[model samples]
Target chain A: MKNVRLNALLAMGLIIVMILSLAAGKVWVSPAAWLGDDLSALIIMELRLPRTVLGAAIGAALGMAGATMQGYLRNPLADPGVFGVSASAALGAVTSLYFGYAVTAWLLPAFALAGAGIGMGLLALLAGRSGSLILFTLAGVILSSLAGSLTSLMISLAPTPFATTEIVTWLMGALTDRSWDDVQLAVPIIAAGMVFLFATGRSLDALTLGEDAARSMGVNISRLQWFAVLGVGLTVGASVAAAGIIGFVGLIVPHLVRPFAGHQPSAVLLPSALAGALLVVGADSIVRILPSVSELRLGIAMSLLGAPFFMALLFKMHRELS
Target chain B: MLLSFENLSLTLRGRKILDTISGQFQPGRVTVILGANGAGKSSLLSCLSGLREPKSGSVTLDDRALLSLNGKKRGRMIGLLPQRPDIHWNVDVRTIVGLGRLPHSGRWGMSAADHDAVARAMEATDCADLAERKAMRLSGGEQGRVLLARVLAGEPQWLLADEPLASLDPAHQFDVLERLKNYAAAGKGVIVVLHDLTQAARFADDIMVMKEGAILAAGPRNEVMTADIMAQAYGVEVQIGTSDTGEPLVVPVRRL
Candidate 1:
């Protein structure tokens, strides 16, 4: 019932903020002018609409992947980030940027998605023979940390002011000057992620008890694990590559929603997806409103709010663990 | 006969776990395997449930070889409760149990029929009340009952439980055992690996005693519980007695 109420409020709020975000830019256009044959219509349709849609879509994908990973791994502490997929994806996007391809509107999200897929695939392969979740987590730590430092080093070595700015923007995350191309690139990948994860709902639910129980219940454990790996890769990879690191959407949204979804991992998927969409779009809308720094990134804004939020979450987790 | 293990031999890490063991489990009878630790009791159950492959022999369902079957086919015939279950999600009690319906349901979701079966299983195990509670938060005994409900809901013709009563406190232990006996009496075959000889003798229609991966004795409780054989398998002198109602009981004493 709380999920229902929250869903209704967030949904209405999302629609309202989305419209305002489309119109309430640096030079505010009348709603009439945007609907007419002015530059405002072009800005709304070709610029803001795609950016918002991509943000919402990627947010849903990341959120769904987080919930799925949490469910499939059966650990609340686990998320797409735990598997190192996010870091690997970031490396992929940065690599694309380092090569100057990140400037090409078409090449950016594509390279990012590939990097995510490869990172996740490698991580899963490393953890494949491990019979324990701890081993998988260990592998994730190794892969992501190694990848993360390497990405940082590349940024440190970047040749010019342009390279530094590009790296920083990618890392901090922003939706400014986002064209329709990014939305196009992210939607397909996110859709594919949703399909893969949603298809494994039953098996993931069975996995809650344990692999032994899931196997006894006729769930193919190895196959289901692959599905989870792929889902996380596709979703988190695309989001990170497209938007850099948007912190807390995966961790916070799913934790908040799963109990209301009856604690079933499968049931939490789309709800997390919707909640993800709302969070990113809503946050992006707020980023638009700050009059002082018009170009202030959505990612930086979120981290400013979420870093403390994350610290609180860590504290809560510690207390619960004790 | 619903299930049979035919000349089964399994080796793990160069040690024989089940050694050419042959057994027939019939419907309406609770067949209990009684043994000391390292007696290959859990391994034997694992082989029967298709968790592990026997090195040389086959477990069958109604003369059909279970070894040749896929997981789905075996799942319909045998429901398993392993010792020390490993959880990967924090699902509710009912949802955990509802997983037992996997074999009978479709890929997308559970059908109404599956839900009904799950409900019935949860009801039988007295866990219906805890349906929405997170399984990990439950006590060890409650968790055991929930897992049992899961296996039961799968509607398997045979049940395999490994030390199913070990984690439970005394009261709930008897309650779970009674449910097992009832399942058997309702024409389902049950093979339980038991550490408690008293409970074994109390509820089992036939007791198979094992030591070091081989059967020490196999017969009705009265014949299997003789002082000499019990001492040989257990490495301790023990007294066997019957209640006023004529049920077998074991009382352990020190080695002579």
Candidate 2:
């Protein structure tokens, strides 16, 4: 019953933020204007609609993906962005650009998806072999560094300066000026990933106990791991391909909503997804209203907001350990 | 129907854990497994619970290979509690116990029968009062009982617990053993891994002794708890006596 209440509140929050997103920009379009055929309606329909929709979609995907990955691996630090899955995906999309495949719409997202799959597969292999959190984090750091360097190398080797600028801007991550075409490209794939991730909720709940007891309880741990990887790869890859690299939303949303969800992985999923949508949509609105010469990238804003929270969590953990 | 192992052997990495062990466990009896450290007693329990596969031979239940059944199907019949119990989240005790019903839960969630089972198990284990409490805040003995309640909530036909008495107080241990014995008397199988031979002798209907990854002896309590077998299994000198209740009592005198 509490979960239902929380879900209802989060849904309300998402709707309110989306409305604020539609009205916050330089063109102040009211909800009344959106109901009629006018300039305000056209701007809302063409511009803010896709941006708000993608923000919620991407946020929900990342949030669900984060909860799934953390629960499946039994590691709190296993978000797609933190574990280099996003960086690897960026590398893949940039590689497509380097090869002049930007003209084709599907190839970049496909390559990004493939890159995420490979990265996650390798992480699963490593994590399965060892239960050491340090080792797992080190492996992610190495993978992220390698992918980041490769992406920089591609930018340096691009044929033209304008191409370099475009790659650089895309790498920074934003949802500005996106149209229905971008939304159409990402929504279905993200939705599918969300389905896959949410389906593993029960298995994750069983995993709250160690592997041995979970196995005794009839959870197929190996299959659950594979499903988590496949789901995270698809969702995070598509989101990155569409809006570059939106970091911290995945990392922060689960932490914020875990308490209200009763800390059960199965219960944590839906609330985290809703909270994620709310966070992104709210952040996008804040960026629009701020007095700035240029639009603030959504990904950068999240990191700026989340890094301090991450630091506080680390310190709290340290104090608990000591 | 019987739970029996046939020449079961298991090797971990390189070293052998359980070496060609064979045994039969019947319902309506509490079977206690006793062994010194590293005697593969836990490994045998793992095999019986279907968590670990034997490199050779088979474990069968009702003439069907236990491992051949899907995890949920097998879990509906057998529940195993490991030596260490851990709850990763700060969930409520009721929610933790509710996890035991996962194998039986349908798509929508737990049924009325499942909820009744959970409540009954918690009541049986004296954990119903702690239902709303955060599971992680429980003490060691409280945690053990909660975990036992979780396993009991499954209502499996066979209950296998490893070192369940380790962190529990003496009263809780006896209470738990009495519950297991009563469950067995009501026509279920209860297999427990115990280090206390005296308690095993007092509570178990049957006893299985292991040493060096093999069973030294296994039979009815009277037949298996002889001085010679105890000495051989533990490399110790023991004095045996009869309690006022007519149960056997074993005391370790010295290391051999």
Q: What's the TM-score of each model vs. the native?
A: 0.90, 0.95
Please write out the lDDT profile of model 1 over residues B103-170, one tens digit for every residue: 78776667889989999999999998999888879888888888889889998888988888876889
The top-ranked prediction according to DockQ is 2
Interface RMSD of 1: 2.9
Give chain B TM-scores in order.
0.95, 0.97
What TM-score does chain A reach in every model?
Answer: 0.88, 0.97
lDDT of 2 by residue, B106-191 (tens): 76788899999999999988999999999888998789888988899998899999998997789988988988887788898999
* Residue A73 alpha-carbon offset, candidate 1, angstroms: 0.7
Number of backbone collisions per candidate, in order? Answer: 1, 0
Badly placed stretches (over 4 Å) of model 1 are A1-13, A100-111, A122-137, A159-161, B7-16, B85-92, B132-137
DockQ score, prediction 1: 0.57
Q: What's the lDDT for all of these models?
A: 0.79, 0.88
True contacts kept of each: 0.68, 0.76
